[model samples]
Target: MSKISVLIVTYNYGRFLAECIDSVMAQDCGEELEILVVDDGSTDDTPKVVANFPQVNYIRQEHRGVSAARNTALKRATGDYLAFLDADDYWKPEKLRLQMAYLKEHPECKIVFTAYENFLESSVSAQEEWVKRCCQFAEHDIACLPTALFHRSILNQCGLFSEDLERGEDSEWTYQIWLQKIPRAYMEEKLYLRRLHGKNLTGSGAKQCKEQRKQFQKDIVHKSIRAVRRNNMEKNGISVLIPAWNAQKFIVECIESVKKQKFTELPVEIIVVDDGSEDDTAELAKQAGAVVCKAEHRGAAASRNTAITMAQYSWLFFLDADDRLTEGAFEALYAPIQKDGSLSAVFSYARDFYDLPGRSTNAGEEGKVRTYSGCLPGCSLIRKEVFRKVGPFDLQLKTGETVAWQLKFRNTGLPSCRIEYVTLERRIHENNTGRRMRGQEQMDYARILREHLRQKKKGE
Candidate 1:
């Protein structure tokens, strides 16, 4: 049997806490229920009222705001499902019963919300447009967390409530749910009661309160827009290709970084091409849940070409086996692509780290941040079609294949951009091919540039 954890967060609403507890205690839903009351430094008789309900669990925290209070209870909650209710609000006896029934009927829905009506404590002047506009008693349906019952999996994927937001935290979380494309259903029947006393933040007639609310709503909208764009890029999907040659020690960590990306609808496909490694790079990559491909004793360029042929998505990200992606790398890179359709690729800065001798950790302490406008594939996300236009890496150059390929990429006259966000960690060590072959790298660069100029003059 599934259980529901009812979370009630209160500030100074002592007088109404008993009513909220009574409503939860009267729930007729068959599921086991656990009620948690998080008191956000209430100065009133809130603790005394909560003491009346011996079964209710009470937690006290210093005044950290509503989001913090809810998060406090969220950490302690043990139920499979979660429901939020304000201390100033009460629900109908059939509220949980009906919502649970809807969930039982629709197995696909991860969340279900019902309509609610607001009631004011005292009448206000008709001339006060702000109060009239803020407080409405009409029954309406909304994506409110307090009126919704959702599975615990939603938080695992969409993340927790933002502690920075004092108000509209519910709306912000709802936006995350939308970004994750979580299946949800709405019940039209008004089953929740919102008590809007003059002290209520949304119902207050104070000018300062009104201004803060307006600003918070605007910030929420901008955040929602960014999240929507990131979600769209996720829907398009990405194939992360890693070309490894004798990279057994670093392959697992590299693959783990891609797996840690917080994608919702579509998961990133990690393809690791083992370029005939003498070590166990192929076996380790396969163990890390990557699609491992074995190729003959060829260079990283040929391995990358092999992976490109196996790629299933239009978008591609090439990651070096020795390097890793930062936490927000995908969002930073792909959000721009979603916003600008003309962009063929997006690149960013990479934080450099030195590999110390005798240290097992391949990723040493980070040193300086450097931008890669040249050969580093770990710093960019490029469309698969761009390869078709620019052509693949030259097989002749072993030391500077990516540098040579980048010159070809520039010659196509395709649009690409560089963002300031640091999305990669480039490891600098003794074994680095570019660092070891400085003379050869310069020669390769000179040759690629000469060819690029010739092609440019031909086009003219």
Candidate 2:
């Protein structure tokens, strides 16, 4: 048996398969290495390309999914270590050599993954920091499949990949391996290059890709639900807390959105804290069947604290009265908590819909907006225990109050994860709170910045 088996699963990728195969062949390792290429019934010249590489052991199978092709390759692989490389991705010549040396040094690690740079056409750039922001990673997390190298023994223990999952199969497999107490090591080197082109599966259809990502997240949630059921853990209920001031125009829509969540198995309580709205906000929330907690003309910070104090569930989700939750938002928020009991909070993306000029563009691809650092208030779910330890939102501040609390939570060193799957639609109109209290907002923001600077100076 060879010491390393390089598995490449391809389907109609004739354009880039040769470069991938050549990278493996160029590895300078002295140990014997075998290349296993599984073709998923490609009608293109992919077979001819593989045939030209005389040393590559190639097999043609029916058009199964990537997971099936990878499993087929695993069955034929006869090596102590197995590494997956996509046909469109290639690794550096020293990738295998350096990873093998690291594995040799750390015998306890069952899986090892390295950082990778992304390429568009011929120009290479680091992977988007927003991607890392959405998903929490160690300093050296594997950015792509080509950077990952794992011992064959991990496969034996964690089982094969889920053939049903067309997207996020690798993430599911890795999460399962971690659940089995298999230690993983990260190499801080960019050892691979992942090509980004229109022909790639994820890049082909933007809407379809987004839907598939949501489906992948649903699978993750389902896995967590199963774990919670089997272990009989403390199945925490979720409190949908909405802090409203003068949101009479949109409070009903917000309450209705929460009531329409996909995951209704867990008990959900809607707590609407009204901060002395002169409008009909309190009446709207009460008529919509929410528990309305009336406060005497306080700001959003005070209203949020009031809702938290009245919350009965251990898990709390703050939803603005003018915002609406996407379908399955609660399920996606609670999934990580069910899977990993150690997590303190889970956040998702919040999209702003404003009629104002220059605000119409979607900020998703524009990288992390400095305006909303930490977690977006309207789209986050947090464990009640975290608030118990870190305390409540800063009622002293008139604006950016939620962000102030998020920063405090971050300072507490806890496991936090963000998924881009769930989204909250934030409606921005003329009567928005920020618009009404612009001066107060600026003042509060300046105060927060000054406090941050003071803290940094003290630490130094």
Candidate 3:
């Protein structure tokens, strides 16, 4: 039989404590039940009342707020499933039966919630009328914490309730369930009772509480949309594009860095475009387990564009042949996009590293590293759709093709974010494209700026 832990958190509600405990004890479901009544330092006759129920486990703690109380109970719970009930409210006798049946039927659902009815404390006879009014306002359609039954393992994955927010802690916790896309189901039956009274937490300031609740709901919905978008975009995993031109010396290390990400489960494919290298760059890349695509004597811009055409995923990461990704680089750059889907790309800082004077290239690799904060392409995790929106890199620019691409991306008014942490280690040495073609890069920068100005003027 499945075991269920029922948590009842109460604060200064001695009169209603018996009724709440009785309702839980009245559960007809033939499953092992562990009922815990956590008294949040109530001065009332809460202890005396709880003592009357010999089967219930009573624990008291200093009043640290509701979220803290809930977290405390969570730590002590030992069951396969968890269910919560408010001290001021009670559940229907069939609530657990129906919810457990639903879980049994739908094995994929990790959590389930039921509809609830709200009634006033003073007028017990006015419940039917109140239910009707709540229906008209669609207030009885929600699934709150009291009506929720979820697997205990969810806490291990999603984490405990936030203690910082004064209100909307339940909403905040529920938002995480939605963001993670956990399989959930909702029953239509109103199986939970919400006792509305003067002392109700949401009744302190009627107008302000309503506005705050609305704002909280709005934020949850907005965040859920962004999370769903991120999940969809992540379905195909990431395509790491590396454009190499005579970079045989550093190609293996670059490819190895991509392969050894902290999140090794993330589906990643490395595509190295050998841009007409005279050395064994293509052979080395293929030996390093990257899918090598040989191309004519095109610049990095053309090679990148060619790689884009060959890419099979929705997300893209550009890695220069001579650069290396830092520890946990993928997780750091991908987190911002997961939080906010409106971002076109996420960038991390890169550190420029160079060999010491008279150091042998073939010897043990030692270099001096310095922080470089520019939003370079090598440190960016971009969505494939961004390429469609901003178009391909400019083939005309020899050294600053990425500069022109960055300008075009900015012109589209799409948002992007940067993580201050360094995710890329860029090697600064001879044959560095930007260092070798300084004069051409300067002219390209000026041309890119002029083009941007012309476009801005035309739009105005």
Question: What is each predicted model's overall lDDT from 0 to 1?
Answer: 0.77, 0.74, 0.78
lDDT of 3: 0.78
Which segments of model 1 are wrong by more than 4 Å?
Answer: 122-132, 136-142, 201-209, 233-460
Worst 10 residues of 1 by lDDT: 133-142
TM-score of each: 0.49, 0.50, 0.48
Tens digit of per-residue lDDT, candidate 1, span 141-167: 126578999888888877878998766
Task: Order the candidate numbers by lDDT, best to worst.
Answer: 3, 1, 2
What residue pairs clash in candidate 1, if any at all?
A: none
* Minimal lDDT window, size 10, model 2: 134-143
lDDT string, candidate 3, 352-457, tens digits: 7764366423212334545665447677888876775677888888877776787677778888887987888777777787778889888988998899899889
In angstroms, how far off is 326's CA in candidate 1?
Answer: 50
TM-score, prediction 2: 0.50
Runs off by more than 4 Å, candidate 2:
122-145, 201-203, 221-460
**Per-residue C-alpha lDDT of model 2 across residues 1-460, encoded as one tens digit per residue:** 2389999999998989999999999998666898999999998999889989999999999999899999999999998998999998898999888888767755766667766775664443335663333233222222344577888888767788889887777767765654464656555466888776555323334344455557655885467446544643233688888988888888998899888877865899888878878999988998998877656666788678767655656688898888787778887777887899888888887766653556553423333332232266657888865764677778789888887777677777889998867467666677777898899989988887787778667767
Candidate 1 structure, TM-score to reference? 0.49
